[model samples]
Target: MSNCKKISLSQILLLVLDIILILGVITTVIVYYNTFFKGSGNLNGLNKFIMFALLTVGITCIFFIILELRKIVLTLIKGNPFVWLNVKALKRISLECFIIASCYIVNFIVNFGENKYKFIYLDSKGIHTDTEPIIFILAGVFIAILANVFKTAIEYKEENDFTI
Candidate 1:
């Protein structure tokens, strides 16, 4: 744990955010311009629009998640990881995760019932699998629990301070 302080995580997260932003722009363009994607499992017409919307929302949520992570990392750097701001940030991140999960799950469902290709691949590649919804949903639940733990920690710290 002591060795971990030598590295700057905030900068790493910032770099990650920058990458996500760049990739997000490229992905948004690709998703919006269905013509660019000429292959099976590609979206079109109303389906394209729906996919574009979902992808936009998912990217936006991820951007916000990184922003909140930056905030939390800043707090950690300040040697105060149990602050209320972090709790709020964690709660926000959890909510964003849930929203992203919902979007992917919706996309999954929308594509599942259709005879045509969906925004997310439900088949092919010699296997059938979709992990986004599960991953985000689990992240949401775990982060929410962590937020509660932080809240409780803050309450305990406050109580300890007052006892003196």
Candidate 2:
């Protein structure tokens, strides 16, 4: 096998994605702090619910961002070509997608009707109850498939390397 370790286009893409993900996490944190911690009056019942949702989604995104950073670090340290096609990487991607979906669901719940306060604190609770579970289930399914794909890709690459 050739010993060349030239950086590939895909590595560049992954690096860029990782940077963007980190920046996104930072932005989310800033927003959360500004909204929740800075002298904002106590979020009332419905506002509290919405704040919790945002916090949950933000935390999830931060976790995924950290995972992506780990993957990037591992790829650089190991000097591997297909590092991003690994189980850990897939898990991170799945988690990121799930966080995004959850954010959309929360946004929908918070803005569902003409009266913004109608769904607060159990009033019209059904309005906020439909989509999150389904989205979470779908995210779980995607994560499983992503894991399998990663394993298969890694195995295929190994087989090809052996053949050559």
Candidate 3:
């Protein structure tokens, strides 16, 4: 597994996604410190804790989404992606997206009346915007619909197989 070998497109994509996930974890820690400690002095203890908790939840949800995507990609590699397992994985991915969206919504609500621009953070490179809850919510809806579509495909496939 450690040796370099011929890899398919799916395998390469999966490897890239894994690398991104690893970097995301590391970046989250740095962002956590910068946002709470170096951002502003007006942030109270409760605000800090809420932000930390929400960040953790959002990250965990993202982690699970990647895991589910890996499963689906493995199925794709096997040339049988339209299976019950993929459907379940898609369902989980959809739920995780919803959870992430909810966490962002909570953060937005918590910082609604704050004086600072809580939604935007400035770093060395440039100003980075937080995740938009509506985007993820819409993604959740789209993934859920896809899961159902896969379910129907499986049903039709099974029926055809039985008929044959």
Best by lDDT: 3
Off by over 4 Å in 3: 1-7, 36-41, 115-131
lDDT of candidate 3 at residue 35, scale 0 to 100: 77
**lDDT (tens digit, per residue) of candidate 1 on 80-138:** 88999999999999999999999987787778856543335544565554577888999
Candidate 1: stretches off by over 4 Å? 1-42, 114-128
Error of 1 at 129 (Å): 3.0
Q: Ten residues in a row with the worst lDDT in model 3?
A: 111-120
Candidate 3 per-residue lDDT over residues 38-128, each given as its tens digit: 7846667898788788988998888888888988988988889989999999999999989999987887788787743345788899987
Q: C-alpha displacement of 163 in model 2, angstroms?
A: 6.8
> All candidates' TM-scores?
0.75, 0.51, 0.80
What C-alpha lDDT, on a 0 to 100 scale, does residue 122 get in candidate 2?
44
List the global CA lDDT of all models. 0.81, 0.67, 0.86
Which of 1 and 3 is ahead in lDDT? 3
Reference-based lDDT, residue 34, model 1 = 56
